[model samples]
Target chain A: MLSFYICLRKIPPMTEPRINPNVSVDCVIFSFEDDGLEVLLIERNAGQNRIEDDLLALPGNLIYEDETLDAAANRVLRELTGLKNIYLEQVYTFGDPARINKQKDQDWLHSIRAHPEARVITVAYTSLVKKSNFKISPSSFARQAMWVKVKEVPQLAFDHNALLEKALEYLKHKIYIEPLGYELLPERFTLAQLQKLYEAILDDHFDKRNFRRKVLRTSFIIPLNEKQKGVAHKPAGLYRFDKSKFHKI
Target chain B: MLSFYICLRKIPPMTEPRINPNVSVDCVIFSFEDDGLEVLLIERNAGQNRIEDDLLALPGNLIYEDETLDAAANRVLRELTGLKNIYLEQVYTFGDPARINKQKDQDWLHSIRAHPEARVITVAYTSLVKKSNFKISPSSFARQAMWVKVKEVPQLAFDHNALLEKALEYLKHKIYIEPLGYELLPERFTLAQLQKLYEAILDDHFDKRNFRRKVLRTSFIIPLNEKQKGVAHKPAGLYRFDKSKFHKI
Candidate 1:
């Protein structure tokens, strides 16, 4: 019952079982914005052509037979956002026997000229970067590239929902170990921004005093001489992260 | 120039570039033993007359066209150790182009009738198990299954040395968050044994008094009435981990 069938725009057809349609890469790109922590997803128009056509899916592509997994992830990211030097960390692998056997999935694959019964094993990856760092443009296979707040994600195409959950869990664990909250902030940000980043990712709140005290003890969160500007209320002092001092909280 | 090749005795030969040799799984099984912190490795006699013969490698196999990555890891672990229901955490993916193209690697894959130019992407996993809980037996692909001290590991086959390094680095980070050191100790162990386990994995010394005080503060470390018997020196008390309290280190 293990079968994998995948077809998307800009991706060359992987109809030949001999070409390893069994392997692919899925990305859960995370970025912080004014709304909150969001994930990048692509929309596909499901017309008479495919059953799952109109659903949203994570931007992904089959790993080329000659390329490494990291390369495949970078390619997909590059193709979708035109971003280079994107770093992807492995999160998990989704290889359920019927991952691609859903009726809608079958229809989509069949409509796209892929072997609908193919079993695909995909390596999922996670990337956290400042959303402003790159401009995103949808690739050919997708009708639109959208940044959806993690809390508001609807049912995704294929097994991307599960992939996204696992990536978020990994990121939650990672933030406490490494002072990576800075990646989600502006070049010079207020302490409140850093705390909010943690709250947004962990989905919880920390007492202001306790949070400030803990962050100050880390040494890496350096207070800048500058403060927030053009604000109606009292502005908070801005801070920057010193990469060299990154260690245990 | 970027071709990839890999070979192991118990592993089935994957020659057809059309068969999708692009995906694989590798397991790094860790357990505490009398010698120290050890990792399970399988010895492959590549051939009776081959340069790479007798090299040790982490137990691994290609992701089958029909199975999930977790199932594949479980199969490899079961084949070598006869244990089922083993849990594996995804570590990382090693997709460096040079992963399987070393001179010794080229010769071994060539000797084994495998296409030395095929690229393979392997998802790596790490599992920490209580050594005494399972019975280990070498499978057909491996001449012998051995548990060597992590520190004493020699140059391994494929890019396993790099794989091992990443697994170790991950475990080090996880230990600070999870009180998993107990998995490597005897059911009823003394404080000394616990301290030694931490020292072995972290590769650093801990002040005995501080270590004892810190461990005692954790609610999960339950003190038992049991103590070591018939030792030359004073026997210390035993303790066990309380799984229910394993949250928020």
Candidate 2:
């Protein structure tokens, strides 16, 4: 049997000193809030390995040599956002050659050169987490990390805007087939919050009566004996996703 | 905006050689016959560039440069099978790294070195085509190309046997959501042939009455005014896939 290191070394060298960029994982963490669906964004450091010093982008990192892609994604979430045990799925591998070029800055090139150890080809992933669980770190490279409404996400660095859009599309497609909505909201959430999350990602208003009926028909949501508090109107009964009944389509 | 070629050149070299020796696409091009489901298989030649000598394998090729994964797949199907415009989809990307190492000959490495022009990262894609349509070319390296029963697929070279298993799994999954079975048979076919095709892939005995009921429920089957001519049993009604409705799902 070929040893692992020999197997790794056996890969043919490129025709030239070509950079076969290493694979990394980027997480688009989404959460449901009172306003609408929100995504976590981090303010990048202004210099030294920071491409867009002031720009916002998804939390991401290079995969370790020994880790699986999913494991790398979990590590990123834990390290960056101080949250764990969230629902994460591989969305797509963004290999369009133009992705890095879209970031028109000398700083980007310098940053890449500065970190010769990091050859990153990011595999974008999406995670749905409860908004309350995060304790965003004020890391040296990031000034702040906060959740912003999906609609208000501005000019993000790299191909992040595109990645976010793809993630949202995936979210909409998955919501119909899988019980993914539970990941975005609190453990016990009002039906209205759930509906708003759907509407935000779907970008259309659903008839409240029809929406409730369709969700209830899935048989994965269980109405709890709990109710929301501090609302101006009648408090809606809280519901939770029944994990036992949830199956991927 | 970066010029396309410039954009391409600026991208990092594929970290490893673009081709992985293990992964590959083995097409199971099915054609309708009087008896049942038939798939195309080729007898490989042992020329300098010909990798699989004196063995049978589904028509396949390695993934290529700057190509969309799907495009590379279509290219392989067209080149090896001489069939185009057939239904093609990425069934899966297999990366059991140890699979290549398990082969005793390590002929895959010699094959890679033999063809300096070719970079072989085998990404296997499965395509379903009406068996009647393909015009097999008599290439010097290939001894012969012929239709074979899915039940008796020859011992394939490399990890092709595993790839075929994955393809069959994908076909079963796709059959439920899409009208892909029609691609395997002729434009017009008896219900028995359709049932047999399903049985071949699913590898289970399905009740004819129940299978027929489910097939008809799909509403994408258009019953023709014709019937089977020389069947030993009752003449079955012929049907074609309703193209307009087939793709809607």
**Model 1 regions lying over 4 Å from their true place:** A1-20, A45-53, A113-116, A244-249, B1-20, B46-53, B81-85, B110-117, B244-249
Interface C-alpha root-mean-square deviation, candidates in order: 2.3, 5.1
Give the CAPRI class of candidate 1: acceptable
Kindly list the per-residue Cα lDDT of model 2 for residues A1-249, writing each as its tens digit.
569879878889755422223455789988877677889988766555544335787887655544556777787777776767776787765544345554442354456444533323466789777777766764635556888988899988777898899889788766656666666777787778888888877778999999899888977888999888998999999999888887665
Model 1 lDDT tens row, B24-106:
68899999865578998987645565354447889886666666678888887777656668888888877765687877766
CA displacement after TM-score superposition, residue A203 of candidate 2 (Å): 4.9
- Provide chain B's TM-score, model 2: 0.74
Chain A TM-score, candidate 2?
0.79
For model 2, state the Cα shift of residue A130 in Å. 1.5
- TM-score, each model? 0.84, 0.69
Model 2, span B93-144: residue lDDT tens: 3333244443532564454444432222244566777665667763534457
Candidate 2 at B134: error in angstroms?
Answer: 2.3
